[model samples]
Target: MRTGFFTHADCSRHEMGGWHPECPERLQAIQDQLIASRIDPFLQHREAPPASLEDIGRVHTQSAIARIRDHIPSPSEHYYSLDGDTFLNPFSWDAALHAAGAAIAATDAVVKGELANAFCAVRPPGHHATPTESMGFCLFNNVAIAARRALDVHGLERVAIVDFDVHHGNGTEAAFVGEDRVLMVSFFQHPFYPYSGTSDIGAHAVNVSVPAYSGGDQVRQLVTQNWLPALHAHRPQMIFVSAGFDAHREDDMGQLGLVEADYAWLTQQIMTIADQYAQGRIVSSLEGGYNLSALGRSVAAHLKVLAGLD
Candidate 1:
């Protein structure tokens, strides 16, 4: 089987504002990189379908869903702010639904043996939107919902989620706080935006807060010392990843100094863990990455590892 690549044009239509960092061009950058790297033809590709409200309800509250739908602006209107950072434009709701749906679909495909693994290239990136609130450019917790789906729909006993976003995946942690079926491991730049993962580490959550200006060596140490041990102990039946590239040194969004090689190494580590415990089942979804060139190159490196073309 091959790796499945999931995305949609609607994902590029969701606009927060003219100057917002989480613009629609993020998707285009990924698509362009896949073609440029000659990685496009090695995988199965599919257009993401809109997620049913029920799929999102697995990880988000009913009220949160209602509010996000209500926040969608009419085509005539320009934008509606969820907070100072996150906002909704004309196509925001459609894009959010599809972004989330991409995760669920990727999970399904990997679980059913239709693909060796999958990568979701849709956005606005998820990882900060909590179970009852939307924040940090995330409309819904896509990876969390996908994890829950693996447990609920696929009848998987245990699943692991690893997030390497520059910012902490507070939303994903919130969704699995007391849940034993899912284990979440993450590394993020602390003292940063939407800061909450610094404290209240959950039993099933291993959140490592790297200080600002840290380098790839520091990140690799944390993953080797902390994340790998927990993953081996848990022995998850499936693995999901919140693949964020905003930690690249060139990205102004965060202070971390991760390069494409760092991302490639991380993906290789995750693949090792998945091969050991999850029958090589892995689903990775895009989270955050702003600098177009870095994001594109980082994603290409990541997919290269996943696609075994490295």
Candidate 2:
């Protein structure tokens, strides 16, 4: 089966500002690179549907949902800042909904045998947004909502989330801290933004934090030593990836020195786990990557692994 490619045009309209690093151009970069790398034609592309409030409410609080809805401004109005970095424009709510919806749609598609695996290319990158709050350029926790759907709607008992973002996925960790059914493994640059996941995370969370300026060797070593052992023991039923490429050496967003090859290698490792325990079912969503060139190259490498072309 072809891998699924999910995205929406509304994702391009949810910009925080002209100078923001999390710009809409990030999606365009990925698309352009996919075409340039000759990988676009090998996948099943789908336009994302907007997520219902009921779907979002499964992972977020009622008050948080109300705040995101209430903060939507008129088309002629200026953007409303939810925090120092996060903001809501007229189209932000729609974009956020579709970004999350893309994740849910991908999950449904993979779980129902319509596809082998899927990648969500939507924006307004989520991972920092918690259940009751939105921050760090995230208004909704997209991957968390999808994992919940896999568990609640698709009857999945053991779901796993692996995040490789440059920053800690504190919000995603918060959503499933003590849930025995879910196992989360991740590596992020330490002593950085959010300043979390350093220690004291619950048993379900395997947060391997590396010092600033660490490179791909550290990532490989951690996966071999820490993440692999945990994943093998857990034997997850489905695997979800919070795929973030900001750790790329070219991206100034974080100090981690990961390159495109690192992402491809890591994805191959995850694929081995999927083949072993999950019937090759995987869902991945874009989270953070600032440098356009690096983001595009890294995503293409990751997609090549997902599509079995590498």
Candidate 3:
């Protein structure tokens, strides 16, 4: 069995502007780090396909998809905003679709037993976008989309989405609130951007909102206490992760301080669950990580764990 790596060149094409933190270079940093660390040699690579309307319809409303597609500009210059932080450029439409599609394909591969697990390395990160609106430099909520696809298309009875991003997965929570058969657990800096996952949205939402500068201990506690218990109870058939490294101290995007070992430990924990209840079935995608060095190192460590090479 091999771990699948999913990405696309168009992900590099989707840039907001020259000064944006969510630049195309983020993917390059990750790719270079994976090769330099020699972690890229042991994985199965796949080109990400564009997600179709039916696939995206699993998570986003048709109107939202229509609005996004209608906003695509002619190859020169185009701009639109669902929020001040998230913007669309000329190639953003294609990039966003591919980012989403990578997650969908990875989910299918893992659930169908085509691969042991998968990782999507594409960009224009999702997980902040809700069903009706996009926010937080996110447009499609990739993990949620994969979860929904697993349940709907693969006919899986139960699935779990674990988001370890520094910020709460508000969009994922919103998408799955009160929805049985899907369990979402997340921990993020409280009073953070798009702050809404703290309180109970309904019966299905489990949030462990932490404060800033709270580092590995709090995160470890959440995983061991809040996440593991719920996961054991749910007995998910598959697991999906919104793997974000922006919580690192070097990353000013979020205030929480996490490091490479933290990410490796988190991946180890989740992979254990996948091995136990889900037959080692897992699909992870990159979410947030700003500082180039920290982001690359953290992601390389994570992939090392994912590929069982660490």
Residues 225-245 of candidate 1 have per-residue lDDT tens digits of: 999999999999899999999
Models ranked on TM-score = 2, 1, 3
TM value for model 1? 0.98
Candidate 3 positional error at 148, Å: 1.1
* Superposed model 2: Cα runs more than 4 Å off: none
* Candidate 3: stretches off by over 4 Å: none
Best by TM-score: 2
Query: What is each predicted model's overall lDDT from 0 to 1?
Result: 0.92, 0.94, 0.87
Question: Which scores greater on lDDT, model 2 or model 3?
Answer: 2
Write candidate 3's Cα lDDT for 1-310 as tens digits: 8999999999999877788898888899998998899888899999999988888888899888877788876766567766677888888888989999999999988877888999999888989888988888888888888898999888999998988888888888888877899888788888888776867775456788889899987789877988888888888899999998899989999899888999999999888888889999999999999898899999989888988999
Would you list the clashing residue pairs of candidate 2?
Answer: none
Deviating ranges (above 4 Å) for candidate 1:
none
What alpha-carbon RMSD in Å does predicted model 3 have with respect to the real structure?
A: 1.1
